[model samples]
Target: MSRNAEHDHSLVMGLDFGTDSVRALVVDAATGEELAGEVAYYRRWSAGMYCDPAENRFRQHPLDYIEGMEAAVRGALAKLPPGAAARVVGIGVDTTGSTPAPVDVHGRPLALLPEFSENPNAMFILWKDHTAVEEAGEINHAARHWGGTDFTKYVGGVYSSEWFWAKILHVLRHDEDVRSAAFSWVEQCDWIPALLTGTEDPRRIKRSRCAAGHKAMWHEDWGGLPPEEFLVHIDPLLQGLPGRLYTATYTADKPAGRLTPAWAERLGLPPGIPVAVGAVDAHVGAVGGGITPGVLVKIMGTSTCDIMVVPKEKIGTKLISGICGQVDGSVIPGLIGLEAGQSAYGDVYAWFKELLSWPLKALLPESSLVNRETGEKLRRELEDDLLRRLSEEAAWIPAGSTGLLALDWLNGRRTPYADQTLKGAVVGLTLGSTAPKVFRALVEATAFGSKAINEHLMKEGLEIREVIALGGIARKNDFVMQVLADVLDMPIKVAAADQACALGAAMFGAVAAGLYPKVEEAQKKMGRGFSQAYTPDPEKAATYQNLYKDYLNLGKMLEAAWSSAGEATPLR
Candidate 1:
């Protein structure tokens, strides 16, 4: 119950490798006070890098992660109090998951090799990538009818193209060079900690239970990954690759290893500091936001990741249907971490913003309203403040006033049956609809998507005790949170920390450094309190209840059409 005296002046650093950027945070391990933080965006990634969104082929070069992490660390260290770096004793990392890349025997991502540097197939297959849609379909078909252990059981009811095996298979089938060369695959979360700890050897990399169970179909019940026979049946190329993969996985509470001398020198940190095993960003974000049993925390950013922890005994033998998998020790040690998400949330709003401003960009190239020369700055101002102004206007319109509804699936569905081929739709649109109406409908669509995920969890008998929300959107957008509260008919608490994921990583860092016994103990000392609470309006909740049924009908209609066209419908 007492703080560590030796660590009283010490700090633990947390690095969060997100989709667009890597963020660093320096926190006092004893007092839980944040000292400094930094964010370094992937420079090449921002400029469209090696990605082709049009093809659903999103890839990130290894150097982006490497440079960004170091830059973020340097940026954070530079802002800290003089001599603070010497006080830093441990490091923790978290990143977007299912983002696995093929690596050589030496543990180098193939994309970093000179010959494969530009090959998309050799790069990290991002979680949002849908290039493996067909491959995922093949996996689902094999799992359902193959008469072996259903690998998809633990990973929701469906395997997603956005996950490990499907992405790997897609690359293997399409790129002969990569197929012949890749010795093994490594998830980004696993690779980063291993990279820092000075071991990339596939044999020695400590895989994360969070990443492997949720995305890679790894379960202790199956002994490890799916049997080699089952994998070979799906594709002969998979022979022996399972052996190359790990059987044991560790939770973030444990130390992955000591920081290597090379990385310590590169990052200007002390050598031999313990590095905690990595996890997906949102799982750690849950810890940062104080996710306990029955408390659900939503990391609402470009996309939404809902994280919850429950007693392992309570979750016994109940494979919650159609969710991003649940894993023991995924969030905190001795508990089960449950994950679910919408692939598009703020992205739906971003899509609406782009849709409304398309003609301005496409048709008004030289107009005084848009040009830099103009004092009015109408176009530039609009581009910057569109969402804010629209949010204000959208707030005025009553729930369901748009007579329109949208499916929040611009990036395809990610949860409650993880189908990537499912597309978005705006139904009931009429000539009377304006930009504000359309925008509000899009926002409502995301809220509705969240409700569906909640419903799925509830159907599996998991009670919704308390709802906590965090991340960029949750903290910034009051209107969205209120709308979400109405849709779910639940009061929502939003975390105050601007960088909750980084704080969570620091909690792990503290525990790994022996500052605390477990993640829960560290969280009690380091947790960021809620900044705001949104209570659902009775009238709005009543209105949304009816609208939700309509939304469900629309989804069924679209999904039926998609299924009839030979694509699989989401599992119930």
Candidate 2:
């Protein structure tokens, strides 16, 4: 089929770079139809590549980003009908954050160079990496009394180890080679779009408001970023970094740049296709979940990110404290996107599943399950279908009947207090407790965390009129959704789009490409609808009220332990 340059409409491409894989989607820009899509797993990442889980160190090579992007985009494009590629006029991107990397003066991720090829210090720091725990604490300590203004005020009162500067500080402190070679740091979300458009010059690449405001402490009040004085106080190494970094942050509503000849040829696309500025996956997922004013959208995957948008006028003088951030035009062009979430949602559940199944493999021989065909089937059921079966049985158990409660902090807490040092806890466990019973308590703990976030938002003067759930857990697990509804006493709507994050990105692409005048217009026409709504049961809600109090008590006890351990009093 011959490519037609005149064909400027009907399709747009959206790329979402997640922790495990990168997903590419081709969508009907006018109708919000998901025409074709594919996911490309990072081959290196799948092999436990560049990661030290024991040390909470996770890194992704820039090669993984390039390879995943080309593979997924080509794979998705190949699935489309004839002439679909020519119809593509715009591209959008979203990625996990604050996944940042130290870069050369040319804006190339240091890991991309031959000298730094095998250096973990040169790689993009994964959002889950907690290698900067001490640096984050130091930042919090310094920012609290950083002379005139507290730079950490906008980002939940407490600085987190999982953010931009913290990881940079960690690398600077530990890796002398990296510190000497690195001129600046760049977020994954910001770098990808710039890379596609061949805007590798450090001063030319457009930075994303979604990433900068939420993770990098960029605000207009004191100019672009937290003053150099504040950063210097945290660490003298950060002296000239901010000046080398970014001054202005742009929202995704605008185009970062057009695709370059090299990237276009590599990805089989037109050279001039508009590329929208990058954003965090959850913020765009909010758009795909039909996010509007007062609607809370939860992107529940490995982690959970809660998103909501409100007008600037509606949030006049009141600061929505204790959130990831409130960034203007992050989700919508004319609104503010508020973010808050648990660091580990589905991750916490996955941890329990592994903990419960370890004995089944270690104590009993795997050969026993493989000996007979039926035994193999039983083993498969135990390994793969465990979560489903547990959830089913847990549904039968009454609220608080488990007599066991768990803290959903296996990784750490993200919002209400962004504490990365908190550990998980299980209380009232007896020999009689079964895996299913304990699983029920774990689910309740996650729901309770969501409730706390909602309460915090309300306390900060934001009214949540609606709740929308998106991502893998929200779609496949009806039991979890129902329980979440019961706990919050709020109706929850599951987004219809299978690739909601990518779809939201497509909406931004449409606007940036000039197919739509504004993001709201693009979203209104191209965004997916609701698939299902979960309503709270009155009885379950009442029972959860009492259980929530116990949860509070348990949380207080845990917080006290942190305090005794010499941590600062949490602001949650």
Candidate 3:
């Protein structure tokens, strides 16, 4: 067979570790064909262990990740043709991030140790966890007043509780056992690649540029992380912590190392296959969707991650304010990746569903209308169909027909200034307000939140030439997309691939394995063009324009109220 024919048959695997599950996708590197995919939910996470929604603490055990990855990879391989597994030459990984875990000197998560088995602080602190709000506030204050370099300049000028340093400080200050045992910390993206490559020493593990630059205050300007003197000023507990962590970071296109024999055997893949460096899910998804200059890719799932890449020369010395971060090579090599997002998106709708279903959960099994089994089945059916039914009904209510207005801050705002202390609100509620009308208002509120981020980006001189959407909500929900298009007054394109993030990882994997010379070549060969487009309706756009002004005014009012009540200081 010719070299071109051999290239056409090569395969790669993309592993995506999400909030609730892990997804593995097997792809043809030459054709972009998705051979097979499997999703495995984390058993412990599904059982609701080690998380407290009331306290805003969400942690995941390393065992869940290990087990789920094995199951997903093996399951995906089993669905392929006989002997197809041997064709796999590379693996790429992406995970929800700024999700950092405490690790011992050997680069093992603390949760794996017998002594810290049950401690939440020992597990991976999930990105949605907001227990570190006070710590984040202190960091933000110190970054501005410390008389040294402003470390938070590139990260939207505000550090978030949902990020790396704040979470580590929160855990260290609260848990003495974990603090003593932890020799270093690792982001979920960095940890997975390190585990696969058998890089056990904390200092030797390859850190992800995507994770380190975006969440860890790592920049080329300051020689990596903030200086030790500045950290000690934030808190004495953070003293000397910087010395144990990494200084160098690599982009996803580079190979972290070859997959170890143990990991390869467990996943039914060959030993010594190149493993591409890991990255946050949104950045990977952007690559899968064919992101380019002036284009924005929004990964909309439970929350939303908006990603855009600009040339390094174009973004020189311009710090975009009120975003997540702008990091070099965080997405594509030689480009600066800019991220911004909401802490809650579909989650806002889920909250309403849970609230409305309280009576069904509380009374279904006890009712005389049915037996326990039948009641349980009925409850499940109702809950599963609730969003679909709401969307159908909500679609009929024209914009501004409902006077209700809401704030999509139930989990607190993530971008346009990161503040977790702010709570969601619903105003203009009356006896005549039906469930669907209120739901429409909620959907509009989320769209308004997105527009805020876009406006902020454009305000800082980044042009959004086009908008692309991906993830579960983007694929499944039509009402939300149409409303979003109307609110932003821009047409939105939905990526065709169901698992764009996983597919993106595979593209990077192909590059790492030398199947392609660069990411652009891989993307051109493997990219799945958009499936559909949502065009803005001019009349509806006009209506949303007026409604958007109302949203901003109400948001300002709420911020003032919070500040006056001493609940929190407005960061912006």
Candidate 4:
């Protein structure tokens, strides 16, 4: 196959490895037109299994990711033109952040080892895993006592249980086999490329600065990794791990390497096709959605990740506290990437649905016409119709009609106040309240949570000029988006593409192939999308503002109650 010139419209592939599945998109390098795409669900036995609440553990098999990758690539290729695969110039990958995999010296997962096959600690820790809450608390205490010299500043002021070190500490303290057998702790963002290329060198594995700085306690001012002395305070094993794990060369647009000959052939593509360093799904979604400087891109789904880019000039020496991370060139070159998020969004709806206790007969009234196999179908149909109707009815009840306010701490807060120990709460519910009213309260609560984050950003001099919303929830839930807009009193720009993260990864492929000079450049050229601006309604905004004040007062009251009673506060 002959290589096309830089301006030629060759095909580029962007593969997004999400928490549930891997999605791939083949796009035209010049026009950003999506030529083909595919999604492959993970087939692991314990794909979505969460460990005990006390431990906060979550695990996934490495084989599941590998299988999903292969399946997505094959599925995408099948939809492309017969000769397009050969013409593909580069590929890029993005994944859920803070997901860590324990690997041996050869980059193979420790779970694959005979001795550690059954050990869950040897498997990949999903980003949502909070098993290391205790360990994270210890790290936070140490960082504060250490006088801000630690690298924890990069990640809002405290290390999260969701990150690499905390999970590693949890496993090391609990699982002897995993601790003894693990040679390295790798980020999922880096591991995918390492697995494809079959290399274990620190130089070979492209660690995304977006993930490292945001989730692994890395800062450029302190030369990337945390100080050795600080790591020693947290855990003696992490002392020397920093030296081995540190990397200075962090650029999102740079090509990490080329596809290995074996992988290329297996996937029906040419060898030496450029592969860009991996990125966080939300960060890449910003690039893919064409959110440039001053724009906040909200990648909303199970959770919502708010991403923004700022020029180096705007970021003064003052460290912006209470955010996911601010890494230079992590999203676009010469810019700082800032991330904030809600730990729960759409999950709240799912949780409510699961808690609904409906009689089987009531849910399946047409049982005579529907067989046992189709009973589930009928139940789902009824449930969906009811939910939709409830949503519509809830919209008519007016803001604050329920005489209730809620704290969206169901899954804990991910930004501004990055606390995971908090629990959800609802106050002022009366006997007259219905399920739809409660549901509306929950939806409003999430919007208020977003408003809190936005307020914090504005206070910190990070002017959020516009919001670009993307992901499944943003597309499916108009009520949620409109409520959010009203609560924040800002226009919400929804992305046109349903799979913005996957498309964003594909944009990186265009940059790696030299089709564009930067990720943003590629986005402008090929990233297709229109923003649906939901102008805030003045009346609704006023009502929400009053309710938000009540919500804040409720938060304080709850905190005081928890303290006085010596009980844990609900809503982290």
Candidate 5:
């Protein structure tokens, strides 16, 4: 048989619920060949429903997930060959972490009910949302003083606004309707699988080990989540919530349950097919990118999620500080998955792009130079090509040539101490500075942020042997990749698969379906190798080393200024 013919085999579907959209990827189970995929953007989210950028509040209705999933699956299936849908043996799911929603006793999101349908507090609190900053700070303080188990220890000794408990607490305290109606909270990652498998009871939902351990402070050492005593101490509003939530969590490789007949019919798939327990996208993406011991797999997209695995025996009893979390079996079974990242990466570029497009946004619709429709089309054309054009020009400028310096904290810092209250800064701007120069500084700032994460890991005694890159920014942006290599002084390889997170989900799906004995075996067979490699330039690396010190110094100065003035308050 030809290579194409040989690729035909039993298929698995990987559904990735990203911030803006859901992606459905179909892959050959035996060979890891990517056959078809489709992307479905959430209509409500695209139109800016239930989000306030100024307030740092981002929410997504459960209907968006349901619609995106069904649409993406059906669209992807349409692109596959004959009988391909019938050959699908398993399905896997991944979603953004810490994206939890208030749910009723029946395990349905509160936003799904008529009364709470339009309430932003009832929707899924997006992972990037920072509305819970005060709540996170309160939890952090109480964990240290409550005279109980320190639930924040495993999660870098700090609770973040962008996590499970803090978001729920924020909603409960602020919104009376949601507070009274919410019987339990469910992470988007865990809830999706439960939705597919027809699990109605919140207690029966198979919680994700990745989501629980990393964000919700679930630990076997602590028996489960932080005790009721500790929670009530933090806030009396949290009383009895733990018992209503969950006591156990399952890894992504395990099956949550078989797909229910109703969902199977809706998705055009076989009933009783295994549905792997859901996990955060970055953990699953790390697996898809072939992450191994000491390999730092960076999922660089809207934000950056840095993932590395260490053997349980090697990392036993040692907690790494100033990261997202280190969870056992979060990425791969029987290993310790360590996650750290920036709260903003590509979003920084997008922010700059939006800033530059203000003239068009302000002037275009009212222009007499063209028809309104024509003006809109031209405006979009320029906006869409803005980043690519900026990157091309920026690449020509030598390192540190532009005197401008930037801090990659537009969406707050996620690692080396997670601080959502910190705002982004751009300093040392001169009259000679151009758009491209400012853009270059922003790109370099993001790269510097990544290096800080790597250095922090090494400082904490976790060795980084190699760096693997995946996600949209990694695959599509060579200029950014080269800058990252120079900043980190390490070679980076991009994963071959375009939809690596989805592909990783499919690997777990294969294991859940009993096609592979373990996740490692599935990865060995299905993993697509690296497509491109970026090597650090010695001259550029030396220049960046000096610039990095300046970056750190500036950060400290700004932090001190904010601390003294008490100006770094969270957006309300």
Candidate 6:
């Protein structure tokens, strides 16, 4: 535990590729003390304009990821001491998963070619982009009809638009160029490493067990991926997709390959430094937050992902429905990793802010007059005032006070029911309702959503002994966390680290660099965090119970209406 620079021997870099930016963290491999970090925001572009609202399609140039990664790494390296660069032993990357990008035989992005540069099909299809709903529905129907035990058991009963194969099929059927040029439809989590090593071998592309199990429907008992027949039944073009899928999917700590000479030279790292395979941002965040088995780790951001690790023996037969996936060794070895989530959280907050019609000019001056002198001081004062007022108003309203309940489907449902066609709704809102009241109800609605998933997990025989919350929203917003605690009737433990995802990535880097023998060991040594647990208030809990009952009834009522109208029927 020497703090002196002369005694520092081990260092690693963790790179996180998020939705809007790439972040790099340089850390002490042995101590997990963050030494330096940097962030590079993706440059927004409207140059091609291929994202059609009518079609629900969204795409991004692959070059954005490349440029963003380089910038982030270079910027972070600049922050480190001159000698620290050479001491960096390994690199690890974590990214939002199931974001598929089409590439050629040489591992070159098809979108980089001039002819396909403007084509949406050639670019990366983000996980949130739900344009493939139709394709996903078809896959689900076909899987059900086939009744394959292997396929149904592994994927928790349905394929989703937020996965690799579904997105690939959608593009292939709609764009002839994509079908012809897509030598491989790769996941972003895997592709980043492939790009770094300059290798396109399907064998060489190391898939994270986390992504493959949760998103791509890979499992151990079935070996890897669904049988070839299942793929053919879904789409003729997918006949050989299984073979193209990675054979030796690895854990987050496993080294995929050494950095290529070009990447090493460009990033100021050793050429042969080991690079761990990519992982889901949320899963890595769990490791970073110091969560062990039976502790549900909620990575709350624009979206929220709930991750838990459990002994294989504890996976009882409550039908464990609604969970995204339960893959063995996906997070920690000798345990089953469970993933469940809500598609929206902080994004809903952003939406509410956007809906506020007041101009900044009008609000800023009044906000400053109320408390501050300088512009920065005024802005901080205003934000504090607004958040405090909102929280107070929200707290005053009883759990069922608004007499309104909402479905947290602003981004679509991800767990317990993986329905993308589902839309958000707020029922029992009257003309007398105010914006703060509505906003409070919306917050409660998300809490209810989390409760639903928790119940599903309980039913599946996994006893959630504890709840650990991590991410900006969890740490910054006390009101939301308290609401969640009341709704779940369980104490919520918030992680101390501001950058849980980055810290988790660094832990993986430590293992890859051989500073630690395994991921669990690295996690124990490197993960540093204090937990803030919120005990449920009996009065609030009682109120939420009644409100939750009403919410369930309303949900059923809405479903019946949709069924009666035949709106729930398949489009095709």
For all predicted structures, in order, the TM-scores are 0.96, 0.95, 0.98, 0.93, 0.97, 0.90
TM-score of candidate 6 to 2 decimals: 0.90
Which residue pairs collide in model 5, if any?
none
Residue pairs clashing, model 4? 422-571, 422-572, 423-570, 423-571, 423-572
Write the candidate numbers in order of decreasing TM-score.
3, 5, 1, 2, 4, 6
lDDT for model 4? 0.78
lDDT comparing candidate 6 with the true structure = 0.78
Give the per-residue lDDT digits (tens) of candidate 5, residues 1-572: 11221244679999999999999999999988899999999999999999999999999999999999999999999998777799998999999988999999899999999999999999999999999988988888888788877898898887889999999899989999899999999999989999999998999999999999999999999898888999999899999999999999999999999999999999999999999999999999999999999899999999999999999889989998878899999999999999999999999999999999999999999998899999999999999999999999999999999999999989888888888878789998889999999999999999999999999899899989999999999989899999999999999999999999999999999889878888898889899999999999999999999999999988887766553213222211
The 0-to-1 C-alpha lDDT of every candidate, in the order given, reads 0.88, 0.87, 0.92, 0.78, 0.92, 0.78
lDDT of 2 by residue, 370-439 (tens): 5556655665678788889889999999887889878887787787878888877889989998888889
- Give the per-residue lDDT digits (tens) of candidate 1, residues 476-562: 888888999999999999887779999999999889888888887888878768888999999999999999988888888888776
TM-score of 5: 0.97
Provide the lowest-lDDT 10-residue window in model 2: 1-10
The weakest ten consecutive residues by lDDT in model 5 span: 563-572
**Candidate 2 TM-score, C-alpha based:** 0.95
Question: 1-572, model 3: which lDDT tens digit per residue?
Answer: 11341346999999999999999999998888899999999999999999999999999999999999999999999999999999999999999998999999999999999999999999999999999998998898898888989899999888989999999999999999999999999999989999999999988888999999889999999999988999999999988888899899999988999999998899999999999999999999999988999999999999999999999899888998888899999999999999999999999999999999998999998999899999999999999999999999999998889989998989998888888888888999999999999999999999999999998889889999999999999999999999999999999999999899999999999888888878888889899999999999999999999998888888888887763223233533
The TM-score leader among the candidates is 3
Q: What are the RMSDs of all candidates, in order?
A: 2.0, 3.0, 1.8, 3.3, 3.1, 4.7
Off by over 4 Å in 6: 1-8, 45-55, 316-319, 357-389, 563-572
What TM-score would you give candidate 1 relative to the actual structure?
Answer: 0.96
Q: What is the lDDT of residue 361 in candidate 2?
A: 61
